[model samples]
Target: MRRLGDLEAEIMDRLWTWDRPATVREIVDDLNRTRPLAYTTVMTVADILHRKGMLRREKSGRAWSYRPACTREAYSAALMRDVLGESPNPGGALAHLVEQLTPEELAALRSALDSVDRGAPGDGPR
Candidate 1:
């Protein structure tokens, strides 16, 4: 998937944070508090996101309500997968990633790996 533009990322961040479908007006109002943005601009960018399959929208009254097509965690995981795919040695890249993890994160990773090794239900493959 293509990376989002600045405005697109900002809009997506808002949608993810809101955790609910939102109309153009609602997004524009919230964003305008941080930086001046026209409603038309926000609406146009939202339509672009929908076209890119990054957002899903439904008609609400006279307007469209939009929400993320995927959750933030899913999107982040995809980005990480993309980066890993680009490495000359994916295993080494993953090792480098592990080296950088915080203690809590490392513990969580260990627990997940252990679950996978034990063939735990709902854990799936690592």
Candidate 2:
């Protein structure tokens, strides 16, 4: 998956955190609580995200309501997949990643792998 820009990320963050469809105005209002941003800018970026297949939008009265097309976890997994796919030493890279994990995280990874092998869902990473 393609990485998001600052504005694209900021917009997606709000939509994912809210876990619901929201208008560009709603996102702009929430973002404005901390920083000054133009509504048109957000609207344009939201449209861009929609075009990128990162967001799904529908007409809501006079405005468009947007939501993330994939879950945050799904996005992270895609990034990880992209990294591993591009690496010349994928196994070595994965081993290095595993070496950096905490004991708890390692256990979670083991459990998730085992669950997958068993065709069941495990408690996700911590």
Candidate 3:
């Protein structure tokens, strides 16, 4: 998967935080509260995200209302997988990542691994 640009990441953040489909105007207005941005620019980026299959859009009046094609967790997992794929030793990379996790996070990771070992539905191949 491709990495998001700063603006695109910002836009996605808004959509994900809002947890609903949003129009370009809504995104621009929200972003403008922190820094100025053009409506056309948000619209263009939204279009690009849609084409990249990262976003799904529907016609809302004359404008498109956009939402993430996948949940934020899914996106993050994909990014982690991408990074691991780039490593010469994915196992070592994963070990390094696990070492950096807090106790609570380590517990969660262990639980997730347990679920995978138990043949959880969404767990990919063994």
Candidate 4:
């Protein structure tokens, strides 16, 4: 997946957190509460995200409604995989990531691995 720009990340964050489809106008209004942003600018970024397959869009009256194509966790996992793939020492990189994890996170990772080992779902890692 292509990395999101500042605006794209902000929009995706809202969609993921809201867990619902939203129009550009709604997003622009929400964003304006924290920072000034134009409706057209957000519409353009949302279109880009749709083109990148990061977001799904549909017509909502005269406007387009957008939602993330994948869950945040899935998107994050793909990003991690991409980073690891780019590393010359993927194992070392992974080890370094593990080393940085908190105790609870480490335990969750271990549990997720164990679950995978048992042919169970790997939902415990996150």
Candidate 5:
């Protein structure tokens, strides 16, 4: 996984929330909640996600329907690991990251790590 731009993240968010693949018109309508965007822009974002390996697209009734290749949480955690895993000492990098977090965030992160250590993400993100 790699760091995604704002548009790519938003498109991925939509796909994660979706129960099924969505067409260009569906994405355009959903994006309308934030701001007006062109159909082409939405379509382009889907294309970018496909290139990034975040999404799978298929032709359906003269339109392209797109779905996420993995859950957003899985993708996010994979990306986090990819970015942090590159450091010579991931433990040190993780410690530094924890040092920068707010107390409330630290508690949340503690719980999340505890959950992962127990077995799997269980009720949270992978």
Candidate 6:
């Protein structure tokens, strides 16, 4: 997976948050805090997402209702995979991934891993 643009990621965020399929108008409404998006602009972005396999759409009267193609975690994992694939050493790649985390994030990761070793699920997936 390639890096998503800001608008694309925002749309995906909206999709993932929705419990039901949303029309372009609904997505635009959610995003309106940033700017006033025209209906056609929202529709265009949604359509692009569908073509990229990042959105699922169903007929909703005249327009389509769109939802996430996958959960947010899955999409993030895909992006991580794409980025990590370019690294020369898997171990070094993992180290680099760890290095970017804030202290709190690193601690959370350690705590989660400890729980995993104790035969438990903790902190949930990213």
Top candidate when judged by lDDT against the true structure = 1
lDDT of 6 by residue, 15-118 (tens): 77766789888888878977877778778878888999989999999989998878888868977775655453555544444335678998887777776656
Score every model by TM-score: 0.64, 0.64, 0.63, 0.63, 0.61, 0.60
The list of candidate 5 runs beyond 4 A from truth reads 1-4, 83-126
Worst 10 residues of 1 by lDDT: 91-100
Tens-digit lDDT track of model 3 for 10-120: 988889999999999999999999987878888888899899998999999998999999999997898766655545445554443433457898778767787664655
Could you tell me the TM-score of candidate 4?
Answer: 0.63
Q: What is the Å distance of residue 100 in model 1 from its true position?
A: 13
User: Could you tell me which residue pairs clash in candidate 5?
Assistant: none
Query: Where in model 1 is the C-alpha error above 4 Å?
Result: 1-4, 85-126
The global C-alpha lDDT for each of the candidates, from Candidate 1 onward, is 0.85, 0.82, 0.81, 0.83, 0.76, 0.76
- Judging by lDDT, tell me the better candidate of 2 and 4: 4
5-102 in candidate 1: lDDT tens per residue? 78899999999998999999999999899889999988999999999999999999999999999999998898776665555345554443433467
Report each candidate's C-alpha RMSD, comma-separated, in the order given: 10.8, 10.6, 11.6, 10.6, 11.1, 10.2
Please give, for residues 53-94, the per-residue lDDT of candidate 5 as tens digits.
878889999998899898878867986766556553555534
lDDT, candidate 2, 1-126, per-residue tens: 232378898888889999999999899999899989989888888989999999998999999999999999998998767655545355564443433467899888777677664644644444
In candidate 4, stretches whose alpha carbon ends up further than 4 angstroms from where it belongs are 1-4, 82-126
By summed lDDT, the worst window of 10 consecutive residues in model 3 runs over 91-100
Worst 10 residues of 4 by lDDT: 91-100
Candidate 3 Cα misplacement greater than 4 A, ranges = 1-4, 83-126
Better of 4 and 6 by TM-score: 4
lDDT of prediction 6? 0.76
Cα lDDT for residue 86, model 5? 50
lDDT of 4 by residue, 61-111 (tens): 999999999999997898766655545455554453433457898788787
